[model samples]
Target: MDENGKIDTRTAKGQATRDRLLAEALRLFAIKGFEAVGTRELAAAAGTNIASIAFHFGGKEGLYGEVVRHVAATLASLYQNAFAAAQAESRAKGEEPIRRAHRVIAKLIAALAASNRSRWMSLLLQREFITPTACFDTLYEEAIRPCLEEFSQLVEATAGLAAESLDNRVLAYSLFTMASAFSRNGNFLRFTGKTGYAPQDIDAIGRAVAGFIDKGLRPSA
Candidate 1:
């Protein structure tokens, strides 16, 4: 950017600066929240000047908004891709709808678990839930709502209820909570006297969660 703080992110160097700022901003904002993280700290963390934050994102508030947008986009992509792949696999194998839902939940849990920044992302989301800002709408509309709607459709198919029905919506939300718990397992770890989970432990957790959900959704013989 020039002295006037006019950002040109189309260029390689400009884009790199913007990316670094966003990366560092996400970490800081997730850990310390938007109000607590100052412009100087953000710039120092990103190895850029304060002017770059203003040029690239307008200001600290603007940068926090962009960080939320970035997080929303990332989560939306993960949810969509996991759901699509699981649905496609189910169709190819002619699996039942309940089983398909189970597969989707399992894949989503695994994907979230495998994300390097899942804990940070979860912390950010918890903040949003506890204290919503204008950006929370962006996250809900872009990521959370879409995923809930799609998962509700899956729940409807398995449970033979309308997707918009209260029961179906509750079921969908509950299933999602179960799947996403792996990403926010700090409380669980502390309670269980465990430092962390291995890959196999995550896999086992996924299977156990899916089994309970599947049993709950199964129709009486």
Candidate 2:
């Protein structure tokens, strides 16, 4: 790895091998977890030699860390455009933070739902959150904390509260958890008699989530 923490393989073939290792590691880790997976299994799964892991990632632990980074980058890429648009819209003149926040929350929920194709990614995250390892800090810093901070700031702005208030943070987490619950489970689709998260279904769910958050965030007279 280099100063930026990226694999520093110089060859295209080496980079391809490294990429394959990370992909296979994520799949296996999401299923068997870190403890159960071994170097041999990872190498065989990636169709590379065991030494390749050491060369590219240092070892299993290093590979796992890279896997977390891979997941973090992948998920961030998925929502970057939508989140960027919301951020820009919120900065517009006469824009209402509360309403924009609601829309952001809705888009987030829908994005998560659309991302269900990578169930393994969420399962891996669930495991990390439940039983963290040495790489938990990397995962938190790279993925979870940024999201929480973004939501917290949005919540503070939406509610016209002092920055970093406990209430704002808690509400932001609650909203994220609510959306995450729907994304992590298949029960939502089963209950709704839907086989897949089609575009129309995602849109309706997003609208509903936006309405719910909007209602909940408003102050009573």
Candidate 3:
């Protein structure tokens, strides 16, 4: 163990290098947009040699894939944990399953808001959607599809709707829309004289979102 009483210096250094690359990559991607940035530029921005990307990630495309995968993995873990916690909470309170599902969605929004990296991921995802690339399929499979399936299941089980129910799909899409609006349109909202929500506003947004979805999913009068 090193002086820090943890892993040795070599392992720590390796992790630091990887984190430096990710941080630089994220900054460049957010500022210049992904398609516009090149490998050498990214290396220079990260204060490393061009060969580092090749060594660390196999090349530019591989690095991009890694960046996307990193974010996707984080989000998947967040959602899974949030859902599990919501389920536990529901069981503890003896609440209806549907209410538990709503609670899960709220937890998800709160999780997203709590992580700046997640917010960056959301922005990067929106950019990817707007400009389809080879990485689109990778992101969709790794991140989007799983989340969609989970949300669908939560809605179906909670609302007692069929797997193929149009209403379930609509509800899932609406939730996605709501989440994306904050993520994708946040800057636009600020520009257009609307509220400039910070990371702390995530819970409030989540509450509002849960309320909206609950009202929509209610049985028709």
Candidate 4:
């Protein structure tokens, strides 16, 4: 606290510095994992010195918590916004819940798969899954759990699955994994010798996913 009552790091400049550190930390952590990343590298990447992390976040671990929050907020904006937007559009049109759910699925595919940062955040999420960290539970509750609840409800509405059941949970997870494959396998595009698709292409992919989902949701062949 520099002998004062507090460090007074709440100034605009300090906040900006803290933000930079969090951003660089997420980028590095996403690639290297938490244990492999060093505070010095984080400082360098953020164009700040090491002490700034201590002043703002208390240390690397604290900084990582902040980064986790940032990642959660980012996903909320990009992924949840897509789902919400599609559902709103579908409802406003007087579409059935099944159709609205289809829109949700297609929008999630495009948002998570095509958006640039989502690809990185997916990598970060994998790191979290591979080994639980201090931020694991918080991140799940703040970001993932809510996402699952929203998804499960959509699935139940679309497929007539019992709510809050194991079946609905499993169904939601499977669908999430399939759509996430877009980002997880994005690098495979180079194999196809084709350019990357845009986020807007969700509409086209929606048609395909909706048709596929409808087939499964149907009563009989």
Candidates in order: C-alpha RMSD to true structure: 3.6, 3.6, 3.9, 3.9
- What's the TM-score of each model vs. the native? 0.89, 0.80, 0.82, 0.82
Q: What TM-score quantifies how close candidate 3 is to the native fold?
A: 0.82
Steric clashes per prediction = 0, 0, 0, 0
Misplaced by over 4 Å in model 2 are 1-10, 76-82, 90-94, 115-119
By summed lDDT, which 10 consecutive residues of candidate 1 come out lowest? 114-123
Q: Per-residue lDDT tens digits of candidate 1, residues 1-221?
A: 76898876568788888899999999899888888999999999999899998898888889999989889998889899988998899999999998888888788778887855766676687689788988999988998898989889888888887887898889989887777777774787788788988898778877888888888887556
Q: Best lDDT goes to which candidate?
A: 1
Arranged by lDDT with the best first, the candidates are 1, 2, 4, 3
Report the lDDT tens digits of candidate 3 across residue range 81-183.
8878988999999998778767977887766656567667777777787886777887778777777777788778766667578988887767765766666
Error of 4 at 56 (Å): 1.5
Segments of candidate 1 deviating more than 4 angstroms: 1-10
By lDDT, is 1 or 3 better?
1
Candidate 3 — what's its lDDT? Answer: 0.75
TM-score of 1: 0.89
- Tens-digit per-residue lDDT, 1-221, candidate 2: 67798875567688889889988999899888999999999999999999999999888889998888888776666546556777787777467777777667777777766653456676687789899988788777777777777777777766655557888778888876765666665688899897778788778887888888887776555
